[model samples]
Target: MTTRTQTLSQAGAQSGILPIIGAAVLGAFLLYAAGFAEASVLHDTAHDARHSIAFPCH
Candidate 1:
């Protein structure tokens, strides 16, 4: 008993939820890899003199 517009709207709304879910999952994986629950060795290494924030280490 739905019109064409309503049917399309429902489809669009359902499809929209997936990208949000995917983004949340990706963020969680990144945080986990960053050692949120373990040792963040990569992050620690990035803080060394070899990895300066400003350009031109010289």
Candidate 2:
């Protein structure tokens, strides 16, 4: 007989995979879009993010 903790853990593990897959798909889509996007557009979108992370953008 499985304990409640074991049951909850199993359920959580199964459900956790969906979010991981979704994030991976989203990341891939964003990467693909960025690849085909214009340089100016990319620069504009990431300009603030680069500055926040202390990355040189200029």
Candidate 3:
């Protein structure tokens, strides 16, 4: 029983790594893109996104 519990816990921990890596990669991409992207492009993208989500950018 103890061994089974340990195995399940290990499996759960391993499964979590993929999402963490994906988030890290996505964050890096956003940072890099924002660093070099045009100001107007970013603003337009953000504005449209806000309106799409009904976040009241105005």
Query: Measured by TM-score, how close is model 2 to the native structure?
Result: 0.38
Report the Cα lDDT for candidate 1: 0.59
From the highest TM-score down, the ranking of the candidates is 2, 1, 3
Q: Over the stretch 1-58, how does candidate 3's per-residue lDDT look in tens digits?
A: 9999999999888786788889999998785454434567765667665556555444
Q: Tens digit of lDDT per residue, candidate 2, span 5-28?
A: 899988887785778889999998
Which consecutive 10 residues in model 3 have the weakest lDDT in total?
31-40
lDDT value, candidate 2, whole model? 0.72
**CA lDDT of every candidate:** 0.59, 0.72, 0.69
TM-score of 1: 0.38
The best-first sequence of candidates by lDDT reads: 2, 3, 1
Query: Candidate 3: where is the Cα deviation over 4 Å?
Result: 1-14, 37-58
Deviation (Å) of 1 in candidate 1: 33
RMSD of each: 8.0, 4.9, 6.1
Instruction: Choose the strongest candidate by lDDT.
Output: 2
